[model samples]
Structure formats: C-alpha cells, structure tokens
Target: MTGPALRPVSGVPQRWITVLGSGPLPGRPELVADADLVLGGRRNLDAAGVPADRALVLGPLAPALDAVAALAPASAPAPAPAPAPAPSDGASATTARVLVLASGDPGFFGIVRALAERFGPDALDVRPGTSSVAEAFARIGLPWDDAVVVSAHGRDPRTAFNACRSQRKTAVLTAPGAGPAEIGAALLAVPGIERRLVVATDLGTATERVEELTPAQAAARDWPGVQVVLCLAVADGAGGADGAVGPMRALAGPTEGPDGWALSEEAFEHRDSMVTKAEVRALALARLGPRLGTLVWDVGAGSGSVAIECARLGAAVVAVERTEDGVRRIRANARAHGVDVGVVHGSAPGALDGLPAPDAVFIGGGGADLPAVVTACAERALRTVVVTLAALDRVPDVRAALLAAGFTAEGVQLQAARLAPLPGGVSRLAAINPVFVLWGTRTAPGSIPVDSSATTAPSGDS
Candidate 1:
C-alpha cells in the first residue's frame, strides 16, 4: 500500500468491446475515452457527436458483424486516428477499444443476439435501455403481463397473426415489410376476430408518435420505420385514458369447464346412440391432450361428442362430417354445450386438406377407408393421432399405418358395463360393445419400439 496508491481494478478497461443502447447517450466517460472504434447507425453516432474517422456506419448486419469480428481479437490493430487529434496523455493507446451502438435494450430481440452469436456472451458488456414494447405499453397505461409478445421482425408474420387470432391481448414488434399496415390487413381477413390496433413509432425519441386506429384505418395509411403494434379485442377491451382500447377479455377464450369430462350420452342431443361412449372418450381425450392454443381435428365427427369434449377442454375444434344430418347434429350439440366448433360438411382425407394442421386428431368413423383416413391424420398431426374401431380385422392395418408414419403406436380395447336394475331390485351388469382404440405419437428416428405388443390382436372382447 505504501509502495503505490491502491485503486479498484476497473472492469471497463479490461472489456475490449461494448455494445451500447441508443437513448440519450449514457455518461460512461471511461468507456468512451478508451473506444478506438465506434460502430453504429449514422444518426446514432451523429447524435452522440462521435467523429467520422472513429465511427463506422452500420449497413447490412452480416457485413457489419464481419467487421466487428475482424476487430474482436486481442492482437487486432486499433482504428485509424480522427484527422490529426493527438492521443490522450497517460492512456493506453496501444489497446483496441470497439463500441457497438444499438437501440433500446440490445438484449431484447435486438443486436445483442447477433453479437452474442459471433463473440459469445462473456466477450462483451451490454448496457441495456428500455425495450420498445415496454415503452409502447407505458404510453397507453396498460399492463403487458397478460399480453403475448411476438416479433414480426425478419420473420414470417403468420405466427403473430395466429396469436392475435387466438389471444385477446398481443403485441407485435414490427420490421420493414411486416408493420402495422400488414398486420391490420391480415386481422381484417380473419372471420370473427375484431382487433383495435395501437401503433407506437420511434418511442423515446423526439419524433415519437402514438396512434390508435381501427384495422381498416391502419391498413389505409402508410406506416414506416421501427414500430410496435398492440392488437386488442374490441368486445373485451376497456377504454384507456388515451382513447385507446384496453384489454377486456380475461386471457383469451372460455375459462370454465363442465364439472367432469367424458360426459354421459344424454348431455348431448344425438340421434340414437351414435356418440362415442363415455369410458372410450376418457381414454381418447387423454391421448389427444387438447389444450389452449392448439387445434384438434375430429375426422368423421358423427354426433360430434368427441369434438365437443375437445372444444370444452380449450382446444380449437374442426368436426368433419359428410351426411347433412350428422353435420346438423354436430352443430346443434356444439351450440347446446356452448362451445365453438368449425363444422366442415365433407369427407375426411379431403376435408382435412383446407383445415389447419392439428396438434391431435380423433378418428371416430372412417367406414371402409379407415386405414386411408388414419394415414392422412397421422401425416398431418403434430402431437398425437387416435382412432377407434369396431372391426377386429382392421386393427393390424391401422396399427401398421401409424407405425409407417413414424409413430410409437399403442392400442387398448375398452369394454364397459353399467349397473342394470333387475325385477327383484338386484343390480346386474349390462355389457356395452367393446371398441378398440389405437393411438400414435411421433417418435424420433432410430428409437426403439415403445409398444410393439400393442400391435398384436386382442385375446377376446370380455
């Protein structure tokens, strides 16, 4: 301590690079003084008053990233001097100091991702600012906790559009082509969904503007540059102080469910008993795993019992039925249960073509084309494929189709008996028809068979 005045070892001098967020320039004097090369947008550098020789203008991301990588190594040379300014006294002029400037919380879906990909996380120190999404929501005085945030920046807008379709609250980060106008136009195309759009542009900057518009209004006007869009359900939103719509829908669709699942046949009004039995439906529903933000296909939906149950469990349902009476029954049962089910009046393997790909599929009636229907469902399904059969001869073929489609196929036969009242007031078992249920899940290639025994024919129907 007596030999030299002890001082705290500063981490800034050791850090070769800094990726700074652009807001009002931060007062990191030590870091700025040491920076030999400053890479940023021309506007950002100009706003910070950095000299042209020391500041490299960012153009395309890939090339700029390459330039940064070239200067990243410890042995790399320092940037050229700005005109004829003499080096600062008693400072390390030999060390290379690189600075990258990005907008608003560089870590939040910003330039940090690219830099991290090239240099790794430990290589750079990031000074974060407020994200555009956070700033956008603050401008309207709305909480963003329940809102689904999606980025359409350099990505297909389909996923963002889908989130808006299925969710009541959503915020989309806009890119060059995928901005407010494109999102608004897409929302208008959705049938029953009506969303009020709130567009916030260049937040935290002097020229910042926030506008509330209808889907049509946003689509009609030209919106350029960096922006954020909030899609709110008009029916559910409460009016905000800025005259913008507030989130009213309590986290998307219906929150309640029937007291229990695999409900009795009487719960739904059906012709005869064309519905899948309660016990069978319980097993099928377990395999399907129907939940929110997922779509399930009910191929050959019959009385729509399975479809209605799926919709009740919070999955979007599409019931495909060929006969007019069957389609009517499906709609009526859906209405009776107070759930939305898209009724497609057509046959399967054909009707499934236009419908969105499903997370799971339930095949209740495939007639003679059961194998073909199973094949089609297996190919399209993302998670599980379940099929019910009454014919003993078709079990092998159905199992084979599932296996061929790269699935871990399993089968179970359910036979149930209800307590019947005898004349003498004694209870007796009344046997219900035994039905074979076959289900398949997508398995990784080269994986061992999980249910090889399931493919074998059952011993007997008890």
Candidate 2:
C-alpha cells in the first residue's frame, strides 16, 4: 500500500516545521507527538517515536521538499462548512506541524536552509543543537573559536583540503565518500605537510568515538560513519596546558591575510638584489589575482618575493627556482612571513610537468628560454599569465607565445622614480630601471599547441 501524501488538514491556518538538532530529543517532545506529518532519517524517526502513519522517511531532498511545499498556508484547502473557531493567536484548532530531524545543528549546513528557502523563515521553528565541528573540537579539549570550519558534504572536497593545508586549525564536515580516509589520503600527497587528524564519529551517541591520528594512520583505516575531522597543525607546544588543549581565542578562524602586499625589498632575503622590486611586484600581483582556494605558480622565483606575497594573500603558492640557494631563500622567506609556499628547485617548461594546474601564473625570470617557459605556463594556466622582463627586445616573442596559447595579450613599460635623500636633507627623484610588464588573459579555456623549442636568452634573474 502507498503511504499518505502530505496534505493540509481543513481548518488549519498555520504550520510549524521544527528541526530537531543533534543529540537526544530536547524539551519539545510534543512537537513530534503532535506533528501531523514528520520527516527525518530512519534513526531520527525511530528515536522520536513518530507514528508510521505520520512519518515520512527523508531520502532524496527534492521529493521531500516538494511534499512540504504542498502544505503551505496558501495551498491549504478551504475550511470545512463547520470549521473550528480560530484561536486568539489566529491558528485554527488543528495546525499542521512538521518535525524535521537532522544531525547536529540543522541551521548549520543542514536541512534548515532548504526548508527556509522553500517555505520562508516565518514558516520554520528551528531548534539548533551543537554543531559537529564544535563537538569535535570539544572532544579534544581545544578551543574552536580560531578553527576554520568547512563542509565537504555533497560539494567539492578540495576546498576543505586546501583550508586544512593553509590554516593551522580546520574542521571538515564529512560525507560518505569524502570522509576521514579520503581527507587523510589527500593530505599525505602534500610535501612537508605536518598535520594531525581528529576523527569524531557517532557524536552524542552511546557508541561515540573520537580518536587522533596522523594522516598516514587515518588514511590506512576505513572510517565508517565519521561525522567530522579536525585537522590540526603539528608544532612544538601547540596544544595547550600540558600539551593537550590550547588557549582560548577571542577571535574565530584563521587570522586575516596581511594588511598590505608588495612589501619592500628589505622584507625578503635575496642575493645581490635579485628580487622583483616592490613597484613591479604590486602590478604583477594585481594581474595574478591570488586568493583562497586558488593555486598560483611563480616561475623563476629568484627570491620568492612574489610567491610569499601571494601566499600571504591566501592563495596556495608554488615557487620554482633553479638555483639551490634561490630555493632556500624562497622557503626561508615564506617562513619569515608566516605563510606556506611550496618551493620547487628546478627550471621552467620542464619542471612545470607533474605539478597541479594553476589558476594563474607569474613568470618573473626565464632567461633565453622566456618564450618557451611562457608557452608552457600558458598552456596549463586556467585563467591568466603575467610576465616581467627588463629587456624590451623579448616583448614581441612573449606576446606571440601568449597569443599562440589562446590568450589576449597586452603590455606596458613601467618606469618609476622614488624620492631619494640628497645632501642637506634635500630629496631627488631616483629613476628605477624600466620593466616590460606583459599579461595575457585566456580568451577561452582549453590548451593550444606551442613550439617549446624556441629559446631566448640564457636563464637569469630579471
């Protein structure tokens, strides 16, 4: 036999949809008992003692939402000939009540959003419980105000992984496929990444479990019914007190990105002044457009000044520098600025292989092979490419390479004069060397073949 379809009872003038948050049923037991129609997962329905005639097992969201939408006040059938008198509050003797059971705080990444969107806020009576992220952090006895919480349920998990990689503390709400094991396996792929995972499962239940494990350990296990995973950076004296919990935080989430960018030359460590000048770096950064959830490549990263700045702006950055000392400088500079930059010790065009595709690329130094390097980067770059060169002769070749790789190219010559100190407290305009800043925006997505054999000048710092 088919189940009863959702329909408004005659004479009802109002409806209430109460979302039961995580944990045992709260003080509002009558909300479920009196509900004309109930909706929830199997466990929630059973736990709430909903009658089979009144229960609607929640599965695929669309049908359930449609069922609820049919019962809105506007759609209610006309009152019976002898309709019950309306209460002083305007509701009739019979008011339709919908109890929506959800895990944790339904208002937080849960069913409340969809319900509210369909029925409007006035139709809902949301009762929130502690979120799984909050419970996970509480299990470890750590303050969560500073933690970045991201949901990977029914959405791209990469954003969650990147947040964990970039921030010191991250809480990821997990789904079946993107659970702790998957998160652990992805983190294991990042070089020099040091993080400990706290997997919390069956929160607020009799079989509740919360365990801490390294990425390798977490990756090796099959995590069934995992609710949330807390990714914490591994560092000396990180956890608070006797190294189990951290101090409370007045603020929440990761500290904001740096107040400013294009820092002065003194901000980074470079050999023989082999860094992109502050003025040039500023415009290059604007063209690159770095932000959270994006990956940027800084090729020929002499001192990694651009890479460090991009990292500070919240983009995942990789710096490719051929010289051994240059790579060291990049790593050191990244640490000095309290940012994470993946330093690759190799040349471009060839070293570009195997690395993940980038949203944007900045080619700061590519000697005689500048054109070929630009071609290689443009081929894989998803959005834009910006190149800086001191030699005006290479502008045409660089522009051609960009065009060949399906980019709309543009160029400008930037020459800035800074105020210099003269004798007797006087000032003079000290003209800096002119630089050709060429940028290309992809006309469309997809790769184009370009000749990699073209060579310009031998590789050198700009």
Candidate 3:
C-alpha cells in the first residue's frame, strides 16, 4: 500500500498584521513603519496618510484576499517539533509583515474574522476603533447596552428587519442596495408595528449626518455613504389618542424567560379546549428553542397559545389562525401575557406564502391540507419543526413527510393525569387525552458532488 502524503509545514514565524481602524488613525507609527504591505479601503488609506506606493486599495474581497495569501510563507514537508528559539530571531525570521486598515472595530462583524480565518488567530494584531453602532448611539445620547446590533451588509436584510420589528431597540449596519430606503420600506409594509427610525451617515467622519425620520420620510430619501439605522419602538401612547404612556423599563426585553412555560390551560383565552395541552407544549417549546434573533411560526394557531408563549420567550412570532374567534382569542391572549404575536387571519398553505421564513415551526393544526402545510413549513424553517397530532393514523404520513424533506424524524406519545379529589377525600388520577409530538431536525447536507447535467441545481437550504 502507498504511504499517506505528509502535510505541508509553514516555516513563517509569528509576524504581526495590524488592522488599523478608520478615520484619523490612532498613533502607531512603529507598526506602520515595519509593515511591508498596507491594505485598506481608499478612504481609510488616505486618512491614515499611508504612502501611495505602499498602500493597496481593498476593492473586491476575493482579489484582496488573494493578494494577502501571496504574502504567506512557501510550503515544505512537515518538520519535527523543536525547542524555543533564541531572542536573536527577529523580523528576518518571519514572512512579510502586513498591515490592514478597516472602518470601526475590525473585530466586530468586520475584516478581523476574515483575516483570522485565513491566517489563524496567532498571525494577527488588531487595533479596534469605536464600532459604528456605538458612534450612532452616542450621537443620539442613547444607552446601547440593551440595544441589539445586526448587519445587513452582504447578507439578508430580512432578519435585520425582523429584529427591528420585534425588539424595542435595534441598530442595523446598512449595505449598498439594502440601505435605509430598502429597510424602511420593508418595515413600513408590515402592519401592527410602530417604530421611529434614526439614520446616521458617515459618523465620526468630516461629512457626518444624522437624521430622525418616520418610515415614510426615510423611504423617500437617498443615502450615499456608510450609514446605520436605529429602530426604536414607539411607546403605547406616543401617538395614541391619550398623551399618557407607560414607564420605560431599564431593559427592553425580559432579563430572563418566564418562570414556567407550557402554562396551565386556563392561562390562555381559548375556545372549547382548542389549545394544545400544557404537557405537549412544554416538550414542543424545548425542541423549538425560541430566543432572540429568531422567528417562530404557529400554524393552525387555534388559540395562538404556542405563538404567545414563544413571544413571551423573546422570539418574534407569527400566529396563523383562520377562524375569526381564534384570531380574537390569540390577540387577547397575547395582550394578557404582555407579548406581541403577529396574528394572521388566514388558513395555511395559502397563508404561508408571503410570511418570512421561520427558525422553528409548531404545527398545532393543519386543517385539510396538512401534508401541504407540513411540507411548506419544513421547506422554510431554518432549524427544527414540531408537529402535534391527536390521530394515530396521521403518524406515518407526518414522519414520512419530515424524512422526505431532509429532516431526522422522531416522535413520542405523551399521556398525563392529574390527581383528582374523590368523594371520600381520597384522590384518583384524572387521565388527560394523549397527544403525539412528532418532530424533525434538518439534516446537515453532506459534501456531495454536483452534476451539471442535472435539471435543478442544489440550493443553500438543500
């Protein structure tokens, strides 16, 4: 048998790559002087007063990354471990020294992560600047400890929009096409959410501009530089008929989750025991893992019990209920629990169309189109999908649907009974109806070769 090929050894020493922050760069003359290559954005390099000959403009990240990689040491066969080197081993012992320039804190959703991933954490030295979110918050004199920061730069803006819709305070890093106008328009489109938008552009720079505007005003303007938006939730009476408002709490979201989940049947306003039993809900919530920055869907939300509970746990929730009475009960339960659950007055399969994708889904009712509804939810949910069924006949069909949709399927039957008072002051078990909780976790798509000849290409979700 042929011997295994040996791994390559990188002979380069731990040379420094300082990532300088943007705008009037902090004094680090020695580091800059030692740098053989200085890479940064055009504005950042100019502001730092780096020589044109030494500076490389960072345009497309791919090309820039390639340039950076070329500076690494050449590969050779692996060598045996050696003792620590002497102090005489200086800058000559390592590869070329590179210094990178970035805006704000490079460590926070910036180039530091990319550099670390490319050249390992030991190869870098980072000098961070005040994050843009902090500067924006400071400009408006608002406390940011409780503020949630999300980025729409080079990624999906829907999650950021969802964060703004649910959270009391949020800061969004804007991208070229996904800037204030796009984000504001999206928020304006969603009903039942009232928020004020604050836009700060070129913060801490010579051309700094900050403006507070309604969603309509923000959607009408054009923003041309680096910008951030602070989405602040409007108080109950800010624009209500009465000018009175509730006291602002220290924390925007709950400091901790509720004392208990899967609360008593009486806790929610349901019609004719339409809500999922407390025992089953507890198990479902455990599987859902609803929390910050996630969206959960409660399909066939009879009383919206699951949706309301999820909202209480700090998740942005959408409750889909077809009946007029179910919708009213859901709204009432949400209000009673001091939580916000977006109630959709429509049936599934048809209703699930325009809704934002969910992190998890709880199907309490599927109506006539159970198969289609389950399939739709499975396709959209990012993490887990939990389905509740009272009929034993539906078990195999539900399990098969989950398995076919690339989820690892499993289930359990839960039957609970409470101690009831007997006529003679004795107690007896009060048997509750059993429920089957069928759940599935999306399988991690393995590395498989793609065939160009195939009609359909593989998707990220697939």
Q: Could you tell me the TM-score of candidate 1?
A: 0.62
User: Residue 334 in candidate 1 has what lDDT?
Assistant: 77
- What lDDT does the true structure give each of the candidates? 0.72, 0.76, 0.73
User: Each model's TM-score, in the order given?
Assistant: 0.62, 0.82, 0.76
Q: Who is ahead in lDDT, 1 or 2?
A: 2
lDDT of 2 by residue, 15-116 (tens): 356666756544446666777788887877898788899888876677788777765666534434564664454322553467777778888778887787
Clash count for each candidate, listed in order shown: 1, 6, 0
Tens digit of per-residue lDDT, candidate 1, span 1-462: 358543322232334567777665444445555677787767667777777777777655676676777777664233333322324542222333777766777787677777778776655667766777778889888877667677655554555665554455678877555578877776665333457888997777788899889888988989865468988766424543222344465563234456889999998877778889999999999999887556778989999999899878767677888889998898889768866677788887887775656778999964788999999988888778999989889999999999999988899889999999999889999999999999999895322122332222110000
RMSD of 3: 8.8
Worst 10 residues of 3 by lDDT: 453-462
Q: Ranking under TM-score, best-scoring first?
A: 2, 3, 1
Lowest summed lDDT window (length 10), candidate 2: 453-462
- The segments of candidate 1 whose C-alpha lies over 4 angstroms from its true place after superposition are 1-16, 28-34, 39-96, 113-124, 153-158, 175-194, 204-223, 236-295, 300-353, 368-384, 389-410, 414-433, 440-462
Tens-digit lDDT track of model 3 for 347-395: 8878887777788999985445677788888988878999998888888
Instruction: Give me the runs in candidate 3 sitting further than 4 Å from their true place.
Output: 1-15, 23-34, 59-97, 116-125, 154-158, 185-190, 216-222, 239-255, 396-409, 421-426, 443-462
- Model 3 score (lDDT): 0.73
Error in Å for residue 461 of model 1: 60
Each candidate: RMSD to true structure? Answer: 12.1, 10.7, 8.8
